[model samples]
Target: MDTYKNVVRILDEVLSLEGRSASFSRDTALLGAIAELDSMAVVSLITALEEQLGISIGDDEIDGDTFATVGALVDFVDAKLKD
Candidate 1:
């Protein structure tokens, strides 16, 4: 699966970024960079990731690093899918 693309899509939908996320690359910062990605949006993003990606994410599996960049989020989901 293209985890990176899926992560960007879910992020755009969850954060209501319209199509802006289409330009996001793996190095694109997320956690403290995007103003739309507040705490509530993070929760929504997590829920959306779980629902859309068909993966259950334990709360303990997430942290600041997971949201640090688009690459990190995709890696997390990829890792979860592998597990």
Candidate 2:
């Protein structure tokens, strides 16, 4: 799967979004809206993303924007992979 698709799947599984992530777009707001995206879920998503993509996410790299939307998160992952 491509980066966006992988990101959608990860969001679905991590957030228990019931596959709602498929319709998510770059402008779709996440973060505070998603009920399952608490602190624990955030950490879980970071770990899962790192393991799946073989990248490292530093603690200081996290922020509201990273979890702001599916697109933002995917872009962040893409940027990390490009490094």
Best by TM-score: 1
For model 2, the stretches where C-alpha displacement exceeds 4 angstroms are none
Q: Write the per-residue lDDT of candidate 2 for residues 1-83, one digit (tens) a residue.
A: 48888888888988888989878897788899888899999999998998988999999998998989878988999889898
Q: Estimate TM-scores for all models.
A: 0.97, 0.92
Judge candidate 2 against the unseen true structure and give its global Cα lDDT, from 0 to 1.
Answer: 0.88
lDDT of each: 0.93, 0.88
Clashing pairs in 2: none
Candidate 1 wrong stretches, greater than 4 Å: none
Q: Whose lDDT is greatest here?
A: 1
- The candidate 1 region of ten consecutive residues with least summed lDDT is 1-10
* Error at 28, model 1, angstroms: 0.3
